[model samples]
Target chain A: MNNRDPENSPVIRLSDICFSYPGGPEVLDHLHLNVYPGERIGILAPNGSGKTTLFHIIMGLLFPQAGTIEIFGEPVRTEKDFRDVRKNIGLLFQDADDQLFSPTVLEDVAFGPLNMGKAKQEALAISRQTLSFLGLSGFEDRITFKLSGGEKKLVSLATVLAMSPRVLLLDEPLTGLDQDTQGKLVSILSEIDLTYMMISHDIDFLEATAEKIYTMKDGKIMVDEGLYIHRHKHAHMLGNMPHRHE
Target chain B: MLDEPFASGNSVIHRLDPRFRVMAAIVYSFVVAIVYRFPALGLALGASLTMIGLAGLAPGRVFYRLLLVNGFVALFWVILPLTAGGEIVYQLGPLDIQKRGIVLAAQITLKSNAILMALIALTATMSFATLGHAMNQLKFPEKLVYLLLLTYRYIFVIEQEYKKILRAIKIRGFSPGTSLHCYKTYAYVIGMLFVRASARAERVYQAMRCRGFAGKFYSLAEFDSSRRNYVFTALMTLTAAGILYLEYLPK
Candidate 1:
């Protein structure tokens, strides 16, 4: 449904990216991906398929041996170059516990805005607003760890949203959520206006939330056309009877 | 599993600002620590008891905490009475119990209980996070405040990790025994916990950076002192002065 002209450049671009851990096999081997503005991209990959590694590299948390990274049409090279990148690009970690490190919910949610140099009052307002948007009103003074699993998940998302990032990199946002929470997350993700690149192994979840889907294999991602399920004739044990098989 | 169970309350002590609580706890603890005379010690202990009563803490829980402290103080009672050389009070089997030693041990017990009770009544009524924020507002070093807050935040997570590791071990048919294998396995478990903790710390740091954290921690906690806080201050001042007066009283 996007009617933007083709002349518009991608918001994030990674070309010829190669990364490997010390004393380990290559995790990302010359992978390439491009994400345009307002694009909701979903990536599907199994464990240890370099999906997380790719996002880390994109955010400059992990440096690739060889890659040219561009964000907002500028080449990112040094640590100074990545400062603006992290400020504008919010990376939601896989584990909610790792994100909500503050003692209270409001503190954790306000942390991002405060770090972005907003005044204390402004940050508090942003945190409250973000929590209210996530249907977490009146959770400001609640203990962070005392929250239920689903509530922690939403608060973690609030922490990222309070930064008002132009782009979001969500890592396995639906991993351990209950069915009800999963449904809530799907609706929330669909309603937000920001562009995001989410990686998860849940194919149905990807299809529901992402406009374009990609699958990862051998440290590389390829566009996923679709899964095909068709009928075929097969012989059963009962006197060569014909049956439909998938 | 780690929790601040006593932090939630609506008593007068709990309603007092945490900044006041922290400061009062510090001053009162110092006064009780230095006082040696029995009369002043008794007054201080009475004041601590009053504070505890005002806080409305559960008597059973408070007594349990005192029992734990006295368990450690029991050691002092055992050693000090025999070791200290003073006028002999009692004669045991080839051992003399000194009067000076008994008096010293009694003083220590009173001081320890008094300080501990005051701390529980003041600081324990507020969550650790509030205490940290109050310290920050009181001009404590920013780095120290951050350390306290971050430690309080992750202590629960680390405890959960510990439990998870223990459960994994139990699921593998491992049981605690006084054997070399059991000792080695326990050692390895602790080593694994440390390794996991360091790795988690790295990820937490990166997550903080992702949110644009740059060595700055801005707190949104606001501590407003009401008339109750002033009354608390006045009471604390009067208690301290009374204890001092009793200590320096003409004998």
Candidate 2:
């Protein structure tokens, strides 16, 4: 994972990451991942496959029991350290509702810029620009809770984009989106010129937006470059017929 | 569904700045709460009703809100008039309704109704975001204001989560009954909901931190105190002063 020289540090580097819930089996066992500048990486994994936990560890939301995480060549340990790292990295939660906590879309989008110490007017200008970039110009005053699912997802992404982070980590972004919305999201994500790592099960969406794909299983991740094809077989309870799909 | 009953109305009262409305409601409620005499209480109630009418809310909605508030106050009517010892006004089976009790009940009813009506007319017209901004401008505790905003935003999501859990249980052919198994299952459902809510709170906190939240809420909405707002504030002050004088000063 650390094949690159120290002078040309990757955007994010994780080595020997091991984490588990207290008194529980390890969820991430010696996992290693490296994200370089301007790369779009997609991580595909089933539920409870430690993908989200890996994200939390990178974001400093959860501390790894044993690991070394480097964000832009700086080691992150304390809350203050994570604070600096977070300024450069933006994470989109799996649930848009969790991310858009403000009462209105404008406020939610402005929150990050304001927290970064921008003036109120400047933060608001940035928010408006971000929303407009996302093709949501007049949604500033919309109530967050009243938004449709796709609208909420877009607003949540707007909140992160308003921060202008160089690195984006998206978790299950296309889970509940309709096909049209997913297409729109793919286009929006493709146009952005930033390094991003997305965890999603939507194969077509990942193929369109991500340059590299990985799969997680049993607390380990491996590169997956082949086309995604799933096969399943089912037997009827009546024992009359069996069905299979490829 | 979450109801913003008066929030969408277009009226003079609805157009007033939320800060002025909040201030006016506080002063009006104080005046109502302090007034003891029936005449003064009646005056306060009339003022509240006038404001409500000016707000142009539906009559049936107003009546329903008043009924909901008075329903709790109605309990005091039955108990206080019978248990309170004073000059007997009426008699029922094994009970005597006292004159003091009737007066106390009337005072309670008038005060609660007047305050509730004033709040409905004044504060209910503004959206919660406007109300939060007004509170922040008034130097209200930032934590409490943020808590209010978050609660208002996430309550619907939590409700939906609860509904999903109940639907899952129903699909499993679990019908609630007056049995130990039913009670245990219900308790487990509540426990699971709590656990889920706790996990969501943690995730929300993480999301906030990822956006650089540092124990403070930064608001994008700014309220300007324009000439209209000043005029509204002045009128509210004058009305409140008059009410206070009428209720407290010698007539």
Candidate 3:
């Protein structure tokens, strides 16, 4: 193999990736992208823009109808192929409830580490540290079902964060969070050096968090922007600019 | 028991290897099952209960919880001693109370207590994940282990669904009066529950598949074997072997 260190290559690459739900129009079509380490790219679209479908493809949670996804320079198709890659990539599901299916905050955080073959003590240690990092220390033993929406979102991230992934996929991290929580979340994401990809309709949050933007419409890449929003018809509907910085 | 504290804080029993604890439980269970003599059974019970106490769980609360399950066990075990003829202790009208009745009750209590105490020690000292790891170490069927893993994962999802179902039923003022159609409605409700559970199972399987779950499961919790582990295993093996020998003797 005439090449340099593969590990030093781009962490994520999609070559002509296309997918569709069974019997549906193509949700993602002929999409190509390369994500280097420490990149924060946001997929901006309205509902049904195939954003989540694209995420499922990248996570290897859904097989694309065509095309290929490589995480950390390893092609993922079979389950085993992705297992090692997923260890370094954390996926936050759009619905916090779906993402959080553990009985307690501690157990939730411990899942990924436990899956990664960490000892219970080590898993517990990682969980405690992540909880503290996310400012959810005292709530370790609290029942997850009793947590509010914002807490659920934060704890969900903490679960992935505990795994210590190098790549993070966040599907709408700010949907239901209040302004204060949203601010905190942005700061938290800003601080993590991991390569990040997000899918959201929040324009202001996209501006605050994303260093680059890619738009998908009707199963194809439509636009790529790396700036504040221009005068678009749906731009005013995001309800994000009301976010407070003071 | 209901108030039993799951093993917290650092102690030998809590810190011991998961593998030993699991093996101890199995060997202890086998020994308890075969023991017919009251003395051997009682000794086993005492030793196991002591371990439970050592694990930092309250003995009173454990006993109370055991008492709760005794009703269910007694319903089955009391049959032979009650109807069988034996040395008469006392008589209540036509009914003859005998030594056999007391012996049967003692046997059931001893065996149940021994088995339960072992379980208490194991559970009190280990979290569910450790128990899972321990189970795998003991060569538990992979199917059963994965079932446990799935059950662990989906329990919260099921609870959320249950709450939603409860809320919907409450809002609709669902009350049933005994009638021909009420039973039909209840049957329909049960059928719906099974269908929903089945669908959820399918979805979970797909999700796991997506995540690259092969036949083997990965747990973040690891078992670190130390000199403590060796000592713990030896102590448990000795106790179990002692119990088995005592139980194996002729009645």
Candidate 4:
């Protein structure tokens, strides 16, 4: 079925998605999510809350037991369908080690473009440009395994961005990053004009980046329209009243 | 911590085309392995050491590697002289050191050290990525080359994961002992590492697929064989031939 539509269609639409690992509890049960163009969506949840499962289902890495996933209004069911979908969707794995498999930073960034049928020289050019864009110009020959954590994370993002995907799926992009690097990343990400759905527990970061916040709980999602600040009624010391620090 | 010690050097040997270096190292090692006499073995060892010097690697590191190799070769000295029966060269109480056994042990030690030195001088100077590209250009098996690349890339990550698991175990008051419980705990640690590695592999593969990786790996690395590569290859080949001639010539 030719389901191609206009560019304004929702970039990703999941309907009644249900997924369960074999012999395990259901992680995503009859969940529905819609991501529109130019939307920076954030999914916040604690460990084991199935936020990553939702991202996997959207990216076609994990197939749901019962659901229909549509990308750009095109229904996806087979590996071929996912292949087409992946051309426009980039995924940044939680572990940079998992994503950056090539020996050097340049080759790792060039991998996506090369696999997408770019010529060797063209892929190299694109990889170089992306690395420079990410402020990693001198890291072309640096070994991926030898890089610092922040550098590796930036290289991983460069690898994804080299593909020029329309939508990005970032899983815990802020984990293990220091404050300075996080601020640098935030500025870099702010300058990019792309839709991204990030899964992170950093509320301040999500608030700073995402246009909409979502909380995943018990295989369901609830929209969090307000700030995620929590208030308590009691103080740490008994018989002491809570007071704000000046 | 298993890093290639001399990989980041900026010397003549380090700058040679990796394909030529790989080919020359293999040929030199074969020549070293066949040399039995002391003179030929010494010549080969001198050449290997000279090349290592040209590579500009720290002499201390080279000696450390040589010491590591000789530690294993030291075993031959103990076993061979006692086992092989020949004309007695030295006697200590109840044991005889045979003349032929001593010669054989020396030959083995010389050959092993020469080959090890040649490899350290030639192959270890290039980064792993350069070596992989060289292998690809030499028509090495694609699957093996890809596997090597992935293994080199992820080995450190797996090591870090193993360390994390060990730290977790230690925090829980686990200590190594000869008890059955300790053995079980160690086994569980190894088993957990394997499980985590397998899961990470799966995630890595998925990430690859997400980025349009089918099965075959396409590398953007390009290597040009310059005059330096040809000169290096010729020099290594002549040295190897010289070693072979000296080893097999009639006395």
**lDDT (tens digit, per residue) of candidate 1 on B82-184:** 9988899899999999988899999999999999999999999999899999999999999999889888888888889999999999999999999999999
TM-score of chain A of 4: 0.89
Could you tell me the lDDT of residue B30 within candidate 2?
82
Query: Best DockQ goes to which candidate?
Result: 1
Q: Please provide, for model 2 over A37-123, each residue's C-alpha lDDT reduced to its tens digit, 9 standing for 90 to 100.
A: 878989888889899999989989899999899999788888889998888899998899899988888989999999999999999
RMSD of each: 3.6, 5.0, 7.0, 4.6
DockQ of 1: 0.83
Tens-place lDDT digits, model 1, residues A1-246: 346677888899999899999989988888888889999988877889999999999888999999799999999987778878998999989999889899999999999988888999999999999999999999998999899888988999999999999999999998789999999999999999998999988877887888877777887777645632123555557646665546
Highest TM-score scorer: 1
Q: Write the per-residue lDDT of candidate 3 for residues A82-195, one digit (tens) a residue.
A: 778777878887667666655568877887777777888888999999999988989887767669999988998998888898888888888889999999898998888888
TM-score of chain A for candidate 2?
A: 0.88
- Supply candidate 1's per-residue lDDT for A30: 84
Model 1 spans > 4 angstroms off: A1-4, A224-246
Residue pairs with backbone atoms closer than 3 Å in model 2 (clashes): none
Model 4 chain B, poorest ten-residue lDDT window? B216-225
Which clashing pairs does model 4 show? none
Q: Model 4, stretches more than 4 Å misplaced?
A: A1-7, A223-246
lDDT of 4: 0.88
